[model samples]
Target: MSEQPHPPKREIFDVPAMTNTDNKGFLRPVDEYRQLPYGLYMSRPADHPRFHHLESWLLPALGLRANIFHFTPDHRSGQRLYLDVGRFTGPDADGRWYSVDWYLDLVDVPGTELELLDVDELFTAHAAGLLTLDEAVEATEIAVRTLRGAAAAGDIQSWLDAQVGGRMPWLDRPVAR
Candidate 1:
């Protein structure tokens, strides 16, 4: 396969400052941020056509950032969850979080059924030297592990609850219609 153009995907979560810097470097105000033992939680308004807001949990231990996009009624796609496989880290000295996306994503639809997306993008990015060998391998492993765990537990939420020892904050919020 030929190498395709792939931009670096990284995000900055500055909870103390209540700001989020998107991959494109646009700064957006955060509505809320909560630091949990397992990860950092962020809820922010999105200036997008399809979704007005989003809530995400950056679970570094699982190498997954789980997202709930509060989609507009016209754009509801029946996707329950979106998981990004990536290297996530945080709170170095400035109490900020970071994420480096690995070009692979998992979309949960209807229920626990997950459809992996962007495998070709991953391979193409790897070929283009955008991701190191270790990162590519790690992304693949995380995606596989998440799928297996969710399948075994009967749902993604169950698997995540087991991992974090309880339900996440996003679980309590009703999905915006």
Candidate 2:
């Protein structure tokens, strides 16, 4: 039998870097990554320091109530990245459960500001053959409609709290200096 054709190589989504260094290290929501051509992986390691900083100083200092999900690398370059399927899920404040799973990319970008990388593009790309489709139905079923709807109404934080709920304890664990 003839050898099967290989799938296309994964392309890194070139998320535009912000020129304003003033807010370079802050974690914030980005709408553009939601429509990019590559996958977005959660950067848990990059989030460790900032997450601690947020819990220990920022949020408390400002009297702000917010919940942050896993951090996504927001750097312009460097490091080898890999894509693995993953899922994020939790209950809303009312106890309704919701979840989103997709191709999670992992990269090493020290000192990079971590932001959420939208995975809808991953689903789209997978559907189009730019990305792999290991679980066709599960991959195709990826939907953030409810999440986006709440986000559009400026209630993303509240929704995130309901879904992903509470501070990540791992971020608060003591680390050797």
lDDT of 1 by residue, 1-177 (tens): 565647659999998899999999999999989888999989999999999998999999999999999899999999888999998998779999999999999998865488899998988888888888888899999999999999999888789989998777784664442
Candidate 1 local lDDT, residue 133? 86
For model 2, residues 81-161, the per-residue Cα lDDT tens digits are 121223322223432222222443322233332223435555555666755565434433422333343355444333323
Error of 2 at 149 (Å): 5.5
Q: Mark the regions of model 1 whose C-alpha exceeds 4 Å error after superposition.
A: 1-3, 174-177
lDDT of 2: 0.30
What lDDT score belongs to each candidate, Candidate 1 first?
0.89, 0.30
Alpha-carbon error at 160 in model 1, in Å?
0.6
List TM-scores for all candidates, in order. Answer: 0.94, 0.25
lDDT of 2 at 76: 27
List runs of model 2 lying over 4 Å from the truth. Answer: 1-85, 88-101, 104-141, 165-177
Candidate 1's displacement at residue 116, Å, is 0.5
